[model samples]
Target: MNTIPVRVVAAEVIAEGIRLLKLSSQDGSPLPTWEPGSHIDVHLDPGVIRQYSLCGSCTDTSTYEIAVKREPESRGGSKFVHESLGVGSQLSISAPRNHFTTSTEADHNLLVAGGIGITPIISMARQFHRQDRAFELLYFTRSETHTAFRDELASGPLNSSCRLLFGLERDAVEATLDDALRNRHDGSHLYLCGPQPFMDTVRAVAARHGWPDDAVHLEYFAAAAPLDAEPQTSFDVRLARSEKTFTIPADKTIVDVLREHGTDVETSCEQGVCGTCIVKVLEGCPDHRDYFLTAQEHAKGDCMAMCVSRSLTKLLVVDL
Candidate 1:
């Protein structure tokens, strides 16, 4: 499927370790109203598509802002966004989509961010500030200089009620988190965005402290690692649209198997993070692997991510 194109009209290096990119529509029309936590996948270079959370004000429809952090082990996407692309550059971006959102019903909001994961959390904070809601921000970073948006966050009006946590000087940040989770008031919702290890540590600590499962929400920036268990045995797949059957080996992904059978399906983020490889299912139980789908979408039993998803039965029927 073809995607819409967005142009970079202007970009500014915002704070330390962050670049605020300003994107606009190519035809001079108002961009879509993206709610808080909305993200767009930027199709850069030949085969690199990276998803970045919209860090600009959601109320602004004329343009969007995204903050990019130069990753140490970047595979050219982040470096390209930072060094190569600039003002007046044309880029392909998918429609604004959201997976992480604020729980409106919660009485208090607790936001936790690790390093660059503050992109979406910062948007949520802006929304909260606009709405005059009560919330707390616990931004964790290794050092003050490496943190993004340090000046804006420390001096901004939103910082009046927000708390900044640094792992450099003391253990006060972890103690604060422990105190908040331990002495929770009524209807407190916790939102977490970070790397895999950080998320795991926070989740484990929260669980150990008796935090409710339903109250903990997570936003991941990376593709989920494949399960460590042994691969399944050989299986067969039936494409409902083409009405063709093919066998899938345990060692091969459904995407490779389908393409080998001449199915020209489009895909990116082959690790099952992006929603690019999703397909509908006609029969048989599907083992979904994409991070895009919500818990509700899985219950419908109609869609599957072909990149890492698999069939439970020996013969599975799928809609291409």
Candidate 2:
């Protein structure tokens, strides 16, 4: 991954629980041009890395915008981004990457967002609005007060094509989904981002409505709980580039095993929400356990993020 050094130019609380951060390149030139739906991995406080979607408009070239929601259960990064980092603070960030890009091949677009998962989808909606494309947004949140970009999504040109669903007011999102599915035409594409159960329900309902697998795109913020709770067997991992092999116990993650062997791997959000520990998979099949990589890439086995993923075979080879 390409890495760049940036300095925080500004940090301000934008709402009750949301904070916006502005970061500029260290060299003072234009920052890397990122497409809609792109996100950068931020190395925040010590031993912490977090991923935040770029919220600034693509027309802007000098700085990137990201908003953070402080979770009550946050280990550190969110609090750091909210309280520690300020103007003139230096940090490292990964180049922008995207797996939720828009597809022009679709006849129409249907976007579903829940809570903070709205970040990338909002960027997609903005791009579609700028290009005068036809699309509708279904944003569901606990309440309008906690929803980000509420005014823009309600009254702007994008609002003309959007449907807002508030959990507090309506008590159920199923009616909205039913209407959207009924109005959805053939060749329409659906993009979804939210918690695991919400995505799962949407997927099951979409399948029931005959939505093609190829027509659905999703981004997740959390990994689904393990399907099986059986203890895993111990395995060996070989680093092909370093010609070194290490034992990985069933109870420890690959990240823990690699770190124990003195490998230089950086990780944050050990839950697999951050992509900092991503590495190339030289050989062996990977049992993907993260939410970072796309479904297509997961199938190819060309790469795996060591932070949360494990090997399927008895011995695995990876590029450190």
Best by TM-score: 1
TM-score for every candidate vs. truth? 0.83, 0.82
Instruction: Write the residue-wise lDDT of candidate 1 on 22-135 in tens digits.
Output: 999899888888988888888888788888899888998888889998877888988998889899999988778776778888888888888888899989988988898888
Error of 2 at 55 (Å): 1.1
lDDT, candidate 2, at 191: 91
Scored by lDDT, the top model is: 2
lDDT of each: 0.79, 0.79
TM-score, cand. 1 vs. native: 0.83
Q: Across residues 160-263, which tens digit of lDDT does each residue of candidate 2 receive?
A: 98877776333267656766776557879999887787787777778778887778888776556762244576778888888999888888888797777778
User: Ten residues in a row with the worst lDDT in model 1?
Assistant: 168-177
**C-alpha lDDT (0 to 100) for residue 34 of candidate 1:** 90
